[model samples]
Target: MKNINKNRLFIASCLALITTAMTFAIRARLETVFGPEGIGLTLEQIGYAFAPAFFGFTIAMIIGGPLVDLLGIKKITWMAFLTHAVGIVLTLLADSMTSLFIATLFIGIGNGFVEAALNPMVASMYPEQKTKMLNRFHVWFPGGIVIGAILGWLIMDVLGLSWQVMVGALFIPLVIYGVLFFGQKIPVTERVQLGISNQKMFSSVLKPLFLFMVACMFLTAASELGTTQRIESLLKESVAKPLLVLAFINGIMALGRLFAGQVVHKLSPSGMLLYSAIFTFIGLWLLTVTSGGMTFVAAAVFAVGVTFFWPTMLGFVAEYLPETGALGLSIMGGAGMFSVSIVLPVMGNLMDNASAAEALRTMSILPAILIVAFFGLHMYMKKRQKTFEV
Candidate 1:
């Protein structure tokens, strides 16, 4: 702690996450910009174009996770900055399906590297408060979405400016975080500090509990991110300002994450996931039925549901599977983003062939499975807690 700047490191992590969240918001706007009304790509094609972001994220995390242990966190972080810069420039010049798809791939990998570098860094920085600190660090995801969504709304919808203007906005953060992390010292990952071998780390993640969470990570990420990524297409038929609804949903989410410690303390991480799944399922059901201002209400419910899903999932692993270390955290994150990659195209196809409501109904099914799975997880944890206490 003496040689390190924890405050600066934490700030850089949040800013990096903010950059990642802004990409999501900007890309959501891009779907409509490049849709039938604008550049004429079909929603399904746009989904295919955007698919790289999630899967690319999965790829980066899978590779970067182990690399973070072998190399230091600082190298992966700078890799994020370079890729983010390239992605932004590419996005600005992009005019075709191939160009947009490639642009998103760089951004996706940059996003993945950001998560890869930061999650373990935070865990190492505050081992005592992994859940609370991780939640606090992740608050910027939705917070950045609100910033990016509103800015997109004002810049495009209100100012009537070009979409490239919004894409260009990412460079601002890309540079700032790069500067902050340039010379600062980063701690060794918790795994390295504990002297656990790579073989042991890899085997720990193969545990039945870790594998169970991996399966659930697929559903949770799809149920949360898959739905939001397509919010514009899903709700455009009903709401005049679907972006605002996106903003509203994330605004509530930002607030929920800002105060997640209290909720996590009371409910425990498994209980929190259970609660989120139920609310998300119910909220997605409401979005399929409700219209107009009521959409915000349904969205508010949805926001509250997904508020803790991502961070809590990471926290649960850090707390329970301490030996899995950076690699474990990366697998959880990689699994989540990978699931979103698979679902985005499916949701888009549903939007194209069927209806938004039908797609939403299909999404709600994921959390329904989660509700059952998490209930089992909660009970399993409860029994384990009692055994430990005795």
Candidate 2:
């Protein structure tokens, strides 16, 4: 800890994550550009195109997880950098559904590599504060969304500038993180530090609790990202700008994540997850009923609900299932992203054939399920805590 510049590594990771996040926001914005008004792709088509971003993410994480140990985070980080560069350039050239799909696939892989390396890196860097520091590191996810959403609104919606400029905004953080990480000393994963065998690490993920969390990851991610990714389509009829609403929601998420340590102390990760599911259920329901100026109010609740979902889910595994190691974390994240790939096309079809309210109502079922799963998790953890204390 004394020799390593963990803070610099942490900052580089956050910037890397921010660069990853802006892609999400920008991709959301691009849905309109390729929709009925601009390039004339259907919502379903756009959804299919975007599907690669998640599934591609799934593939990268699944493969990159093992590679992180074999190849090292520095190599993985450069992989992310290269893919992101390619993805961005391809996005600029994208004109059809196929082009967008291929571009998004690269971007998704880039995003996956970023998480593959960074999640465990952050955990290893701050062993005592895995959950807390993870939440903090993830703050930039929404923070970058806030930055990207606002930029999209200002550049495309307000200034009437070219969308290319907005897409190019990715390069700024891209180069900065590259510079920050250059020549810095990196740490081995916690599993390596503990001398855990690769075989044991692989087997640990099969634990019932770890598998349960992976199942829950599907719903939690679908509830949060599945909705946010389609904000423009979901809220197209609203008076408020959908991207702005997206920005607002992520703004609250960033702030909440920034202060997550206190919440972690009081609620514990499982408890935090249970309450998050309950809030998400209410928030999604509110989004279905609310309209116009009231949409922001609904969004705020949704923000608070989803704020802890991603990081807390990852943190819970990293903390409780330490033996599962990077592969466990990657599987959890991969499941979440893979679920979003399934839900996106479904949600788009719903929005295409039915009303946004109907789509939202359907999406709400995910969190509703999470509420029950997380409650069981909460009680299970409480009982485990008692046993450990004894």
Candidate 3:
């Protein structure tokens, strides 16, 4: 390939990172507005509204992956910008659950599009450094959270600004990304650029290891994002400020992801997943039992546990299922977000009737679920590796 416009790529990546941070800032705080105390929606209802983001993300990926091949990345990136802009605007106006739901759907789709285009873009630009670069690229997920968290603290805590202002902040990055991609030429996806056929790509995605890895991705996304997004309502009784806890968890997560390559190389994905599950389980258990400052401490540990979960899932897919190309990357992201979308309501409902600790205990079932799933995944991959050698 010709020398990539490193400057343009960096600009595009920064746009993606800031936008991702913006998405989470809104998603993480959805409960603050729509929860029992805010807009007076039931926990179940809030989940229903939030479901659109994940569902829209899934829809975008399932549809956008091949479309990216057919339509090209430039069109899709612009679509993301437009949809994200509209979504944020609608959400700011929403007083009812229906409007909020639809708005979130739009934002979610936009966020998915960001993944659809940007992941492949980064991978394409840095072909030889897939895992390392991707990890560094994903630093934004946590890094953005740190930015959003600080913003949330400032807007909500310091200035007492409206949540609408927080939601509206997304537009700044949206406009910036739109402008960055305006005159630029987007290359074909990595799979296409490599001259791999669609059949080969599909076959790679269909392999047993790929499927197993996707399963792990689903659980990891659900376990990490699902649990963290619900922290506000889940720990209302234990912590004085739930948002601060959210910021703290994400702050540590940013630090961890920034340094993930060295750690992943040492521990390996499966090894990392195992330890992550253990820490998550312990952290949830601690949240259930502890109160006061210890709660924040446990939340931080939970954050550390989950730090590698999402990106590693993506990184593993890039390594093991490169054939799925951009399609696989998009699907993994969609699936992970969709899984978390499903969990949000269940968490909300548990919080509605039971105590926060009880809700946390119920959520604990997920990490336990991960332990069993990852163990099986580890063994299955081991067995599969033997066949290739034979």
Candidate 4:
């Protein structure tokens, strides 16, 4: 194999990071626009609007995963760029709930393709460092949230700029990433490169165990992001500035993901996941029961809990279900976002009728359910290995 271009790979990784951050930034702002007092949309309405991103992501992943193998990365990369551009343009024109929803759907689809194209691309480029590199690569998800949150504060809150200006900020990175991918030699999908048959990959992805994991991933993602994205509205009664709180939580998450290699090296993904759930439980409980800066602390703890959840889940699938290939990873990503899409509206409904505390308390059930699910997954994997050996 020819030597992998570290510089190009690094550039690609950065673009992926920026795209993730941009998506979340827009997500964060959506609550602001569609929240109770902003444009007079209810919590449920905001949640429904946000649903498009996850559903679009799921659509892209299920559709694009195989295409990445057949059509190659260059075509997928261009698709991501075009979809993102069109989505953002639609979002900027949004005036009502209907327009906002449509725009978000397009943007969500674009965001999903970004992951569908880039994740396996990165995994293939740095084959030897699958876990670490992927974790490091995923640093941008939380990292971008932090950037988005801070930008939210700077443009919308502190500088008193129009929210439209903040939405427009995404165009900068979209153009840059597009430029970076231009003329770049895209790497082969990991499954193809490993010489795995498409049938094997399909079977591995659709296996009962894998499907069960996908179910758990969806709930975990919904529980994690659905709650965090609403931190501003949920804590509006407590925090003087909700966006600042969002920034603080994401700051810790970004730092944690950047250092995830050290954490993963010390603990198995299952162990890390269990630990994450515990922290998430404690954090959510505290957020629900407390007030003031303590709420921020709770948010930080919750961030730490989920810090490893997204990338680690991918790493787990990659390590344990390698035959599932890019399709599996795509499904994992899609399922996660899809789960969030479903949960966002539920959270919105809860907040609409019940108190913010009630909504959070309701969301807490997700992690509790996952605690049991992870243990089951661990046992299943162990039993599978035993069966394989016999």
Question: What's each prediction's clash count?
Answer: 0, 0, 0, 0
Please give, for residues 283-324, the per-residue lDDT of candidate 3 as tens digits. Answer: 888888888899888988788788888777777777767778
- What does candidate 2 score in Cα RMSD to the true structure? 0.7
TM-score for each model: 0.99, 0.99, 0.93, 0.95
- By summed lDDT, the worst window of 10 consecutive residues in model 1 runs over 170-179
For candidate 3, the TM-score is 0.93
Task: Highest lDDT: give the candidate number.
Answer: 2
lDDT head-to-head 2 vs 4, winner: 2
Looking at model 4, residue 206 earns an lDDT score of: 77
Off by over 4 Å in 4: 1-4, 379-390
Relative to the true structure, candidate 2 reaches a TM of 0.99
Alpha carbon lDDT at 67, candidate 4: 88
Residues 1-390, candidate 2: write the lDDT tens digits: 567898899999999999999999999999999998999999999999999999999999999998888888889999999999999999999999999999999999999999999999999999999999999999999999999999999999889999999999999999999999999889988888899999999889888999999999999999999999999989978746999999999999999999999999899899999999999999999999988989999999999999999999999999999988888888988999999999999998998898899999999999999989988999999999999999
Question: What is the alpha-carbon lDDT of model 3 when measured against the actual structure?
Answer: 0.79
The sequence of per-residue lDDT tens digits that candidate 4 reaches over residues 1-390 is 375565776676677567756677657766877676788887788888778888988998888888888898778778888988998899889988899888888887787788888888878877777777788888787777777888877888789998888888888878888877777667788898889998899889878868987987887788778877777778888778777777777778778888888997888777778788878878888888877878778888888888888888888888778888889989999999888888888877887788889988888888888888887766766677789999
Give the poorly placed runs of model 2, Cα more than 4 Å off. none
Off by over 4 Å in 1: none
Residues 24-88, model 1: lDDT tens digits: 99999999899999999999999999999999899999999999999989999988898888889
